[model samples]
Structure formats: C-alpha cells, structure tokens
Target: MREFVVQQNQSHSVLITGSTSGIGLAIAHCFARAGHHVMLHGLADNETADALRAAFAGYPGNQGFSSADIASEAGCAQLVADTREAIGNPSILINNAGIQHTAAAHEFPSDKWHQILSINLSASFFLCRELLPAMRAARWGRIINVASVHGLVASENKSAYCAAKHGLVGLTKVLALENADHNITANAICPGWVETPLIQPQIEHIAREQQIDLETARAELVGAKQPMARATSPDAIGELALYLCGDFAGTITGAALPVDGGWSAQ
Candidate 1:
C-alpha cells in the first residue's frame, strides 16, 4: 500500500456502507485516520461490529457502527436518519456495499437478481435522495460509489452484478451533473479483482471448479483480465478513495476511474 499524507483540517462526517470488512472497512479507516468522523454501516455479528467500533475509537475522530440493512428504500431512509442523528449529516458518502451471485442469465434466480439490484443500484439512489439535500445545503459534498470493472465491461455468469454496476456508473454521472453548481462531486471507482472476503468465495469456487490449487486459481483469475497478473490490494482502493475526497480532486467529477491494474485499458 502507498502512504498518503492528508492535510489537516476540520473533521468531515463520513458515512460508509458495508464497512464491516473488505473495501468498505479499508475506506472507513482511511477517512478516520484523516480525522474524519466515520460511521460504519454493515450487517455483521455483534462481536465483530463491536470489535471494529472499538478499533475505530482509537482513531482521531468520532467513530461508530450501524447495522442498518440498506437493501430496501425504507432501510436506506432509516440509515440516513440514524446517521444524521449520530454524527450530523455526512459530507462524504461512500456507497461500497455490494453482493455477487454467479449464474448464467437464463438460470439466475429472480430473487437474487432483485436483491443484487436493490443493494448495489437502488440503495445508492435511495441514500443519495435522502442525503443530497443536506449536502446541497452545505454546498460541499462527495459521493463515491464503489463500482466494479464490470461497470465498464462484461463477463459471463455475472449478469446481475454487471447490470447493477453499470446502472451505478450512470447514476453517478447524473448526480455529478445535477450537483455541479452545489460543489458536490460524484464519481465511481471501478476496481478489478481485489483480495477481499467478498471475492474469496468466488476464488475458492474457481479452484474447486477448475480443479486447480488455490494459488493457481488466483493466478488464473488475475491473468484473465488484469495485466498486472495479481489482484489489487483493498488498501489501494482505499487510498484512491481518500485522494478523491481530498482538495486536489475538486475538479474531478462524473468519472468512472478504474483501479484495475489496467484491466479496463484492455
């Protein structure tokens, strides 16, 4: 991971969804270390959530955890309200919660498709709808969506995920244009394969299905789309996210930046 030195400033309230682990957790830590009040939202066991909250308390700003299920409109509303009550309105919102299911489009379960769309695409819209007003009033905000390389390209057996991410990128563009006058920047980060708990299951499944060792499975997975021939570190994505929220990125908006080891370049 690269080292970054964030300029000192007054704390900004940051709300990150699906922050219990993986990419979301990394982004939360990045913001917290930069002296931002961070509220982590995810579904996890009490012990796990408490541990994360305890760790976050050691950081420089107010830190808390929320177990709000953001896959529904009502849940998204409640999460926004609860966050506002806990840490005021968030000036930085990271929509990093997502789930993946693999199956041919013809065989994909209807319920799974709905769930994916709700959490990955619809939840972002709901959160933005509830939060953008306050951000506009504040006249400064950042909306970062953790999209995937699938947002820009396609792969077999990932129909729902691809669709949701594509929709997310489009939504990001619209938000950026609509909020340009308000000093609110909206963008999407399209990461390729990253070594996270979310993708570990898929890696293991590849090992089993391809009858290869775990190491070979990992290599093959990365070889397919990433020219670097390795999965990205979650911290790398975190670093990019931190950069996007910094002062230098004020002019950057409505972009789908790919941190994919050149996967999208292909």
Candidate 2:
C-alpha cells in the first residue's frame, strides 16, 4: 500500500462519476489526497458540485465538475465533454454514480424501476461508451464499476437495484473482454452495505415499514450478514479504487472483486 501510495503521479487524470457524496466523494478525496488529478461528476446541483470543485482548487492537481445527470444520453454526453475539457481523457474512471429503490418485487413502481435502471445501469454503460475511444487510443485505462453484494445474491426487497448491479457485473466483464486489446481493464466491486446517503433512505423506510427502532433495525439488517457484521466504509472504497487504477493491478481485469465484509462469501 505504501508503494502504491508513493507511486501516485499528480499528472494522472481520474474521472470519478457520481462523486458529490458517499463512496463517490470518498474516492475523489482519496485520489486527490494521493496526488492524482480528479474530475468529479454526479447528478448534483450545478452550484453545489462547483462549490465542491472550488474547495479543491488549491489542491496540487486539477479538480473539476460535471453537473449533468448521468442517467440521460445528453447528460452523459455533457459529462464526457466536460470531463475531457477539464482534465484529459481519464486514465481512471470510477463509475460510482448509482441509486437504489426498495420495495416488494410485486409492488415496485414502474417509474422507480425505470429510474433505477437509467441511473444505475444505463448511465454506466453510456459513460463507458463515450469515454472508451479516448482510453483505447491511450492504450490503457481502468473502469471500476461500483456494484453490490446484491449482484451476487438476492435480498427480500430491492428488486430493481439487484437487477442493475447484476447487470453491472456482466457489463464489466464484457467491457473488460472488449477492451483487452487496448490494455483497458474493466472490473466491478461488489460491496455489501455501505453507510452512504443512498442507503439511509432505505434504512429509514425499513425502520418505518417494520415498526422497529431505527437502531434495532440497523442491527437486524447488519446482523443478518457475516464476518465483521457492519457496513463497509466509503474511504475503504476510495482506497480500493486507488489501488485498482495503479500499475500493480495491471493484470487484474473482469474480476468481480467483493469488498463486502464476507457477506457474499457465504
């Protein structure tokens, strides 16, 4: 890890999508702190993401913004264009923008289903489609998709989320194979539960739906899992992405690396 940290070059441009908060923000800070140029993007307010960008202006490398919602084609195009303009074509792309909607499979609203797929699945694909040309021309890149333990196994609720993450794994594999000739690698990180804003709403809804104390509900959800029995931290993800983009992981691609604390190991 120290060698990896020391190897960080300030010149590398890393584009981290959906980086306004949660795992995305953590990754952004990780790369920045590690001395890489970072371009952060998300379905964020123009002013807010820009404010965050401004805060990083004093950092050693370039910091930038992409305010467009990544779920739409136009938004994705804008993101690619803005990212290219800000830094160069990203040598590292952490496809971390995602959303989750929980409901019984039968009661899942149609709009929610579409929304989840658009943001979590389709957007990731489009971002890759738009950026791959540059990466291929460079002959090296890392595409790290933030997937979930749900991609490996099922939960009672979160049908649409599972579908999208499961698809992400498949997508990662295909992208890896397709870009192998260019030395561009694609991989998925299947995290169990993380204490991100994305999960808070589900926690609140679960607490209300089950009529349990929030703390108790949280424990119940976590206790059901194995090993460390707690959610992974966002910084942990940041560190992982940092490593995946490093030269040490040059040979690792198309692998669904589970950063889940042994949850999917069961």
Off by over 4 Å in 2: 1-10, 197-218
Across 115-229, the per-residue lDDT of candidate 2 in tens digits comes to: 9999889998998998888888877778999998888888888999999999999999999999988878899998887877665766788799999887777766776784756
The weakest ten consecutive residues by lDDT in model 1 span 1-10
Number of the predicted model whose TM-score against the real structure is largest: 1
Which residue pairs clash within candidate 1? none
**lDDT, candidate 2, at 3:** 42
lDDT for residue 184 in candidate 2, whole number 0-100: 85
Candidate 1: where is the Cα deviation over 4 Å?
1-8, 201-214
Task: For each candidate in the order shown, give its overall lDDT on alpha carbons.
Answer: 0.90, 0.84
How do the predictions measure up, each by TM-score? 0.93, 0.88
- Candidate 2 has a TM-score of 0.88
